[model samples]
Target: MIKAILFDYDDTLVQTRKTRYQTIYKLSEELFGTKITEKEIDAAWGLPAEEFLLNLFGRFSSDIHYLWSIYIEFSKKDLNIPHLNAFDFIDKYKNFVKFGIVTSSSEKVVLRELNELRVDTNLFLQIQTSDHTAVHKPNPNVFEPIFALLKKENMNKEEIIYIGDSPADYESASKFGFHFLGIAHDDRHTSYFQTGEIPFVRNFLELEEYLIDQYSFI
Candidate 1:
């Protein structure tokens, strides 16, 4: 029945390259006293921010809490909207199904971008962020809370699908037995398609069409 669709917000909903560039550069300069290049930051984009920080900075004595505070403050100010177009078909179908955003980003950053983009908050039944779940993508624990939330609404796992732009997302969906849609075209997303573990679409337009076709039978 696929009563709901869960989305990954960063590279899936909006382009992530520029936002990563700005946030990484600003944080590196402030924390390390040196500017890190975009190329370096891009390499760390798919992983958790804290893991990325630790990898770059090593285990510093400073509490992770302080580092995250700085990262969030920098990200909020630097976030930029990328070239985005509405999945018009999905927009049309919204009334027929539930939708939500599940991302590795914090709620603050997600809310800020949603507000800036003027995406209707009412469109999503739930917004699950990394902060809400102790485990991030590639970890089934993150999906557990989402399932619990949806179960409370009488939704079954079979009646949901997850769409995202990374290999970790594909792995998460597989672990949870949810249909996975991998967003290809971006280099960051190519691994999912190349592995052929999940179906892939080039863009939202293609995804919208695929969904329309797939759901027509129902």
Candidate 2:
């Protein structure tokens, strides 16, 4: 039986993609003097923020660092993006199973967002962010801390589920032997997971149903 669910922070736990794209695009023009298109940003979605910056800007310079600082400052403001049904989801099943977060995001931003959204971070058994690992998703090392923690608790790989909104999440979980579940909030994710024959859900309600029906998560 699945005993835990590790979540991705950005598009999976919260709806930050569109707003994030807008922020980056606007800042790219202002800071880099390059008017990057939303399409370009979309193409590089799911990468770690610094890697995304390097991928677009072709280097990680002082200006790139400055841009990241500005982005973090911007994130401190209300982007008006509502978190997903994670609060209710965790509250419902938290007693039955452990919860964790594994993301290619920074700990500072993730914690800040969770606080701003009024989520009880204590409900999580562990949180492995980019800061917690030297390498990141699609590389499998990003899951090292969480995976080790689970093993120490006698939880097998099959007993954990990794839920996220991107292919990188699926790839890393697969490589590391955890079950994968996709959050397909848009056509791109839906089509990608469907093409890969991966199981996915449209929202937390459907996710609840999927867990209950498929994993006996009741």
Candidate 3:
């Protein structure tokens, strides 16, 4: 009876690591006069952009802000990356259920990518961006507004599930009492599951199978 599915935008639906890592590397080089390796940036992937900057530099400064601006500019110039692909199962079942994207990314960039990819916005009942809510992921506040939108549309919480690739995504789903499907194809996600707090799958194909099994029981 699941009526809707909420997806995380970055690593969940689209391959964003390459672009993000490259941007961070460029930023690091510009701000610190040193190149940041992909491994270091990858380690900091789940953090909010500004927090990631602070974590790398140890303090906030004008140069960090300038670098961020440069990264944003770079992100805007090109949205295409080599490995980007929508989840195949989701694409196949696109018409079977309502869909939405919930992410901590800025609305501008999210919309830009969605438009670039030609995602059918009409399939979604609601799309929540970090800027639209007072709190970001790992906090229930992000889900609260989404729930309100669902309730207004007369949808039930039990009829929804959230799929994401981060531990924070699991935390958000747990806080909102939504079923969680963890996507762990990357090392960052694999490392997160080592803590043993949640169950995870290697990719969306595994998620498709897991959902079929879980729903069969319901």
**Per-candidate local distance difference test:** 0.74, 0.81, 0.73
In candidate 1, what are the lDDT values of residues 49-76, reduced to their tens digit?
A: 5676655555443567777777777777
lDDT by residue for model 3 over 1-218, one digit each (tens)?
77788988888887787567766666667656887776777666766555665566654364766656666776765574422335456567777777788987767677777778777676677778866776778886688887887777678888888988888898889888887778876777676776866777776667767777877522
RMSD of each: 2.8, 2.1, 3.3
| Candidate 2 lDDT over residue span 168-201, tens digit each | 8899899999999998877767878989999999
RMSD of 1: 2.8
What candidate 1 gets wrong by more than 4 Å, as runs, is: 37-43, 53-61, 86-90
> Which candidate tops lDDT?
2
Which runs of model 2 end up more than 4 angstroms from their true locations?
Answer: 30-34, 57-65, 78-80
Model 2, residue pairs in steric clash: none
What ranges in model 3 sit over 4 Å off? Answer: 30-32, 37-44, 49-69, 77-88, 194-197
Best candidate, TM-score-wise? 2
**Displacement of the residue 211 alpha carbon in candidate 3, Å:** 1.5
